[model samples]
Target: MDSSDTPSPIAEPLPYAEVTDPTYAEVAAQNFTVEEVAPDTHVLRGTCPRCNAVLEVPLVGNVFHGMRSIRDVLRKRHTKPSAGDRVEPVICTCEDAHPNRPEGRSGCGAYWTLLLTTEAK
Candidate 1:
């Protein structure tokens, strides 16, 4: 069989600047809150309350609920998240004492991170 017979793998499109660019710091500046809906599960749904922008983090299966940072949410949202997805906090850049703030706005510019958990499929 000719190797060319098979189609090339498709590359996924990158998320919007608001989702990927570190320079776009508004998302970090925005206010949000996390809510627990069940044991070992959570529904992170909030907006940049200051800007009225919609922010959502939905855990599907075996994932556990815990504190997470803005960057973590952005990373998962841009990547492939499925059932048993574990999310947690590693660092943050938000000025409001958020867990994910790494640069902390004044230092290297605002950035955040979230801890992720998931079960093997």
Candidate 2:
């Protein structure tokens, strides 16, 4: 118990006009969904599948084929995005919008991948 002896509760702040603000076609109509977190690594939770524009809080997304998409469920993969040894790919996409990553990079302009499996840990 080292977090200030724990036990802190203070909540109640999400009432922004009945909290109704989810567009982008209702979050691309819920697509792209994966979660393996270990055994190789995997964490693709619907949306951002290429310019659908990051959505979080239900409802997923799936644009054409150029924003980010990687769902390699097994077969030993790692083009980089997780499980260390960063090489690039994790829904990567700044669209080569150039600015040199790292400095608070949340996505590059190209390269992508992040849902590989097949135990490498």
Candidate 3:
């Protein structure tokens, strides 16, 4: 067929759906955790292993080498905290943390605690 006679391909638009608030399940699937460390301070933890940086919520302060999982503890890698850092336990959904999923999601729960630490000189 001649170039001029050839029909051009038509581009189709992607089907769109209205954006809605994500359900607790969806957010939970994303593994979002909220925990209170101290008065006015909170923690929002994620599943990313490299997310070792402990952030003090509401106050927006951060402390390196904060609490970590047993897996992280066994790894025993040295991490340093800057001038303003505090160590707080991770809030997670694990067998050690909660006996059962309080929200009705079979195995979901939160474990929040303070991290025992030896500060760097």
* Per-residue alpha-carbon lDDT of candidate 1 for residues 1-121, written as tens digits (9 for 90 to 100): 6998989997542222222344333354334445567765665554432223355555544445444544444455545656555434322222332323334241112224443443233
Higher-ranked by TM-score: 1 or 2: 1
lDDT of each: 0.41, 0.35, 0.36
Q: What's the distance in Å from true for residue 89, model 2? A: 20
The top-ranked prediction according to lDDT is 1
lDDT of 2 by residue, 1-121 (tens): 6999988885432211111122322332236454444453444555543444443322122211222332333222423334422222334332233244455455433223333323242
Q: How close is candidate 2 to the true structure, as a TM-score?
A: 0.23
The weakest ten consecutive residues by lDDT in model 3 span 13-22
Q: Give the clash count for each candidate.
A: 22, 9, 1
- Over 4 Å off in model 2, which ranges? 1-21, 39-42, 45-50, 53-104, 107-121
Of the candidates shown, which would achieve the greatest TM-score relative to the real structure?
Answer: 1
- By how many angstroms RMSD does model 1 differ from the true structure? 15.8
Please state every model's RMSD to the true fold in angstroms: 15.8, 16.1, 14.7
lDDT by residue for model 3 (1-121), tens: 7999999996442222212232322332244444557754545544422222223233234343343332332222234533444444333332222232354332123334332232344
Cα TM-score of candidate 1: 0.31
- Which parts of model 3 have CA positions greater than 4 angstroms off? 1-77, 93-121
Name the weakest run of 10 consecutive residues (lDDT summed) in model 2: 13-22
Give the distance in Å from residue 102's predicted Cα in candidate 1 to where it truly belongs: 34
